[model samples]
Target: MDLATRATPLATTTVHRAGRLRTGGAELSWHADRTTTPVVFVHGSFDDHTSWDGVVPLLPPGVTAVRYDRRGHSGSSAPGRTVIHEHVGDLVSVITELSGGSAHVVGHSYGALVSLMAAVRHPELVRSVLVHEPPAFPLLTGDPVGEPMRDAARAHVITVAEHIEAGRTEDAVALFAEKVAFGERWRELFDGPQRAMLAANARTFLDQFRDPDHYALDLAALAAGPVPITLTVGTDGPPAVRRITEILAERLPAATVHTITGAGHAPHLSHPAEFAAALARHLDRTHLDRTRPA
Candidate 1:
């Protein structure tokens, strides 16, 4: 069933009779499958829930699924600056309304960072978490590989913001794509969605870089937080992606790390089957572990 027909868990949440609802700085759109203990997926920058189209069918049976647009992405409305933490708050609301407080959360790229922060900030709501290649740039500050990653990220963000600010959105998106090494592969992998995402989300990316703390998260809080998190990165992914995951995993050594052998940054798009299977297995294991007597 869609989130529209569903009665929300709380009256405090700003929900609309329509398929849209108010959350933070945006009117968000959400979809939900009709099972319990939902698995909520959060998309990265410039993407909406539909990006999970390829992976949804492959999920384990009997578990509910939910996904939503962040502020200013896809069907969601945005009226203010898009701070990353604001996205975190939105995820909290989505999970609250969809799962009545608990869900296995999965997030990709920038969304991954938001998931981690949400787990830390609202530990009661998350059962387990999986994140793919979140660009947690602050983790790389002292790393040899991470330093270059930071430099590249800073350069890319500044240039992209400049272009967007100058009303050169096409040029800004081209530069952003180039920085990510989008190349022919991004076009080939995403079909038309990538271009559309960039055009729709150029301004969001502008505010994404406004903070020096934009990419920074309290890693120690994440490591010490109660939720069990799994960091997933594609083997063929860039150095920065892998390094960020590695640093985070090292900090949370008890947490798991899984690699998709042939995959790249956008594993759901580039390697949907593997990504879906891994997530399904993790959910299975988490359920089994929870049910086991300690």
Candidate 2:
């Protein structure tokens, strides 16, 4: 993971278009409008709606970028002991409420996994999906080569979970940033607010792993679904992330792969302009003019 030639950080914009959606005994907080040509941005673990602050403002004019704080993170309610499907359901509900049934979904890490599951479960709600580094670890289980990777990943997960459970959330955040998100450069990359956000939501990361199907995905169902997909990876990311992206591109019938040069796990944060342009291209090629905003 080389950080010597990283792209200049984009200027952060303050978007005050905050709103809340009450669903299934929990409240999901989100930013931006419910306009036509909606592109919902789902943030990963230890993150909130502002994860897309750099990328959202750069999208084309016709595109409405909706970024939400996933349930139990940031401004969202923390209903105790939830599963991955609930996150999936929350995403589906967001799309239905804001986009009038269908929208382009851009997700990162765990959020990417949630978006894919929603597409598989309710294809009609997702016009297109552009996901970066979904940790679908179940896809690695049982294979001779993947078994070792899975084992190592499991150990890392347990260590992070233990740190959180022990109330060493700051340590957990630093450990995850070092091992998964950003290499040693996490401290340099994450600003004060970004680091605060990660620390604040550390417990939710542990809650996610409590679900039995946290990393499981039915590849067979995803392959049979009709939703278009653009699976993105960073050139300099961890090998495990690359492997998961390859697995998705191989298993999903309508999936295409995109690579961001000199970027790591969170390109939307590190390489905002490139990430945003890639998303815009995916949406434009979808030819969503039929549902253009009035």
Candidate 3:
């Protein structure tokens, strides 16, 4: 299960719909396998569907894995306003159209926040949710721990907005990759190719930053929902992210939390085998329960 090699066979394509506009005219791209239950993949800020490039093929034969560019990112429609709720709406529409019903959802980083919101809002449309390192800082109560991290996230968002307004997307991406993505491990985890991808998608990354609601709205609703969720934090993730996972596991009803060993914020990219194995196990458990005598 060499993740880099597995990524090669995964195909890419764009999706467009004229009748509905969740994110003010949505455009999406995805990777699919015709034989499986559709698995929708959502990426965080600064990346596109390709972020899942390293993990898509590792999915079993019966799962159709789909990843999309967030509105205003990559080939997706560029909406004038960006917000987390809007992104969640876009996901609902996309999932409805692509999966023909509720589907299994996997979201990474900020994308995880969006997916959680969708589950909360449209629980009927989601069978199971896998959220990897969602930054739900404002919602994590009982913690003075999140105060500094939340402030840092806020400042980082402001910095990104300022840089983008100043037409400094490259610098914004660099800073985000260094300060947010890999954090202390930026030098060790992000290779030449990863850096290139981040640099290329700087504008979209900045879109999320300029609009604080891109994360805030989702975090607000995550605490109120009853959606069944699987929360994952990379063993090497930032302390804040790990704390958020702990909060969800402790607070969210019907939620399970797990940590991926030897992985960071992006385990799907860094340790595809372990990531896929975890997913497979989750899917198996859920599927069995759904079919059990009731």
Candidate 4:
């Protein structure tokens, strides 16, 4: 995929407004308002909450849209050797402080796993969970059918780490672009924030990969849990990512799946209006607006 071929057909603009929230040990930078049923957005690996900028305004004006820099991402404090628990704990505190202990949540890629885990660990804090293409790789483990996929993915991570440890940051970045990101298409994203964010948070990606719980979760427990989850994928998304959503939907009967036509990977960026609509509909259906301030 050449960068030209993968380039967005339209020139999209962003609305930039920034503020900071004092949460736990880190002062999280965010954009939001105080409202009963706030919407909290979590960004995937190598990105910050501003990744939701284009999609946020399209959400219903009646609802509050909140996003923040996760630890180690842009605009957030970088603590030493943080793990999945710390990430989850940050979200728990943020939601409690921002939305009075309950809010609708949307997470993309790596953030999707974090959001789902938050719901699983603290259902009382979440009114709904929406995820896009989370690489829940652990679900591919143990079974004869999925074990190979797991091993291959783990090997890929290890190789990328090895490259970085060799002090070959450029090599590691290129490998990540070609292997994990969409090959030459990654260049299209590099012209903006994606490339810089990936570079800035490279070490945290290492920590995330090393964290046993980074991609590990008990799907059965989640499936039987109370919070309703909706998983969205782009129609043109990679087969592996589509498979993750399929397996998750199959396991969690309460889960709903939506395909964004003519989009891939990042729907919030590629198909902002549709993504926002889907999110608003889910929140309305779930009556998240009814959540009261704590």
Per-residue lDDT tens digits of candidate 1, residues 88-177?
A: 888998888766788889999988988888888998998889999888877888898789877886787788889899988878877766
lDDT of 3 by residue, 1-294 (tens): 222222235533223222323444665554444433667889887777777766766765456666678776666776465777778888897788777777889999989988888887898898889989887776654478777776776677678767777888777766766676666666565678766766666766655665657555343455566556788888877777787787677777667777799788888878877888788777776682353234
Off by over 4 Å in 1: 1-18, 181-184, 288-294
Ranking by TM-score: 2, 1, 4, 3
Best-performing candidate as measured by TM-score:
2
Task: State TM-scores per candidate.
Answer: 0.88, 0.90, 0.83, 0.85
Q: State model 3's lDDT.
A: 0.70
Locate the minimum summed-lDDT window of 10 residues in model 4. Answer: 1-10
In model 2, what are the clashing residue pairs, if there are any? none
* Each prediction's RMSD to truth: 5.9, 5.2, 5.1, 6.2
Q: What tens-digit string does per-residue lDDT give for candidate 4 at 98-193?
A: 667888889998889889999999998988899998888766666566567566656766888887777776667767665664444666555545
lDDT top scorer:
2
Off by over 4 Å in 2: 1-16, 289-294
Count of clashes in candidate 4: 0
Relative to the unseen true structure, what is the C-alpha lDDT of residue 55 in candidate 2, on a scale of 0 to 100?
Answer: 80
Model 3, position 64, has a per-residue lDDT of 63
Q: Please list the C-alpha lDDT of all candidates, in the order they appear.
A: 0.77, 0.81, 0.70, 0.74
Instruction: Judge candidate 4 at residue 172 and give its lDDT.
Output: 74
What lDDT tens digits, residue by residue, belong to model 2 across residues 1-294?
Answer: 111111234322223356899977789997764334678888898898877877865666556677788989989996787678889989988998876788889999999999888888888889888999999887777766666776776787789899999999889999888886677888877888879889999878998978888887878887887888888899988777788788778787578788999999989888999998788777767776655544
